[model samples]
Target: MTRVDFMQGNIASAEGALAAGCRFFAGYPITPSSEVAEHMARRLPKVGGRFIQMEDEIASMAAVIGGAWTGVRSMTATSGPGFSLMMENIGYAAFTETPCVVVNIQRGGPSTGQPTLAAQGDMLQCRFGSHGDYSTIALAPSSVQEMFDLTVKSFNLADRFRAPAFLMADEIIGHLRERVEFPDTVECTPPRPIREGMLPFEPEEDLVPGFTPFGHGHRVHVTGLTHNEKGYPASTDPDLHERLVMRLIEKVERARHEIADYDIENPDAEVVFISYGVPTRSVRQALLDAPEGLYGHLNLRIVWPFPENLLKKFPNARVFLVPELNMGQMAREIVRHCDQPVISLPRLGGELHTPQYLLDRAEEYR
Candidate 1:
């Protein structure tokens, strides 16, 4: 039977991870995200899973990557400061092609700005925080229910691409309480197993190699340094290094359209509001109260690789209005992909844009 209950967003995310077969969790307690670790501690052991509270975010990230190589689905959760501490390991996970999920329940800050407040300031950080060039998938949820749905999707994406996936949530969604339906079962796509006689890092047509877990007798060597198809470090070979890095990026970039996920309403409207995360709440309300044909909304669930093609969906669009908690991080991407006038509505200090505020902005373009 399906179970329905009123739950907080962080709790729902934990439940979703459990449903998605996450057997290992290594996290450091951080505000707006500690509940995720707390829930996992209480629930993982009951299901015969492992949950460890690491000394800090950096150690937590390393533990999760180690857990993934052991053939278990692993994850970690954090807020802004913790997220920052994990950047080095995040890059390591990307270079090694380790499949894991990192959930960032965003809070205000450059340095511990507001622990108990909501902010979407980390939108860009998740995409480029780690040094070097690589591509990873990121999903943003706007509600308590999506906090569950998207967390499951993050695991699926991680395993599918053999790369780290991020759940970029904010404090508002992390703490929000709402009704969520727990399905009896969730379908999971496990990693493709390495076949005999195949090179460890050799990729198939999709550019994603089959996974060879540790102790699998596959003779695999995992390293963050540039490597050859046989998984041996080849950093000295310039051409080979280029090929390795390019493949890592193209595996996700070429599939951008396939991984793209969003919601489009009033596709023919001249004025449009593009948003994600908590700001999406205000956009929904503005649409509901606007006059017929007044404006449209493009709500994004997946934000990385910036599905540039989605801009064409609004053929009649004269202007695109973007509202975010950051200082126009994603709005700048919109401007790059579109010829239409792009306006950014930025809100900071841990507050959400009111419905009236969005509607007022829409009127300017209309």
Candidate 2:
């Protein structure tokens, strides 16, 4: 049995986190993303969870990291400016192998560019924003139901990969109100516990280390500095640092295709549109409004690690059209992955790419 109701996307995200066994939320309110924190505030304590409104995004992110260390699923929600503020701690989470979730309801940006609007400008930033090399899992939702489903998924992915996972929605999807179906009980994947003889940072065969929970009768040192399997700082050893970072990266990258979530339709069509997040709505609408089998679409839900192989699934694709809210941020990724001519359709000003607009653009490429 399940429950169905009209739900706002941000609220659905909060509920999703709760369903995923997320018991800690620390966030500062920001437009377009604040409702997630608000909903968590009203809902968390009732479930015996903790919710805190920190001074700012930086502190919120740090609090999330601290909460995760205490052996709980933790998260924070913010938009562009707040996302930027959390970069340092995000890097810390990556270095220390902390499992947490960060909800970035992206808005138009560069410095509070458009607080009330949406943009996919942070597409690349979420993957490479921090100082050093690292990898993360990021999910882009095109609907309210996905906001709920993917939040749960982010938690599970974070636990599995032992790093931060991102729910990268935007103002459009974050604010959209739609009917959502609630599962009877969502499954939660807890981190693997420390084995009897393994060190804190020592990885299993999968390149991911088992988690050392607090009060497990084991004391483990944690730091962001280059560390050994025992979690002691070893910043001076070049080879150890290289091995550590590479594992941090490969744990996610090596499993990228397995982690990828996308849908393909009309695979035989010559003109393929690759998209994610809200811009994908336009492509779907365009396909629906056109003749059957006239075009193909690859809609990606997991954008990070790029999932370059999905493009090859459409063997007959002669051209791939990419429509993004940013200036072709993701389109550039497609350019490198395939030989087909890729047409980038970029839109600004917080507007959806109308189906007519998409159809008109495809017409020009022919």
TM-score per prediction, in order, is 0.99, 0.99
Model 2 Cα lDDT, one tens digit per residue, 212-242:
9777767999999999999999999999999
lDDT of 1 by residue, 146-169 (tens): 999999999999998999999999
- What is the model-wide C-alpha lDDT for candidate 2? 0.93
User: RMSD of each candidate?
Assistant: 0.8, 0.8
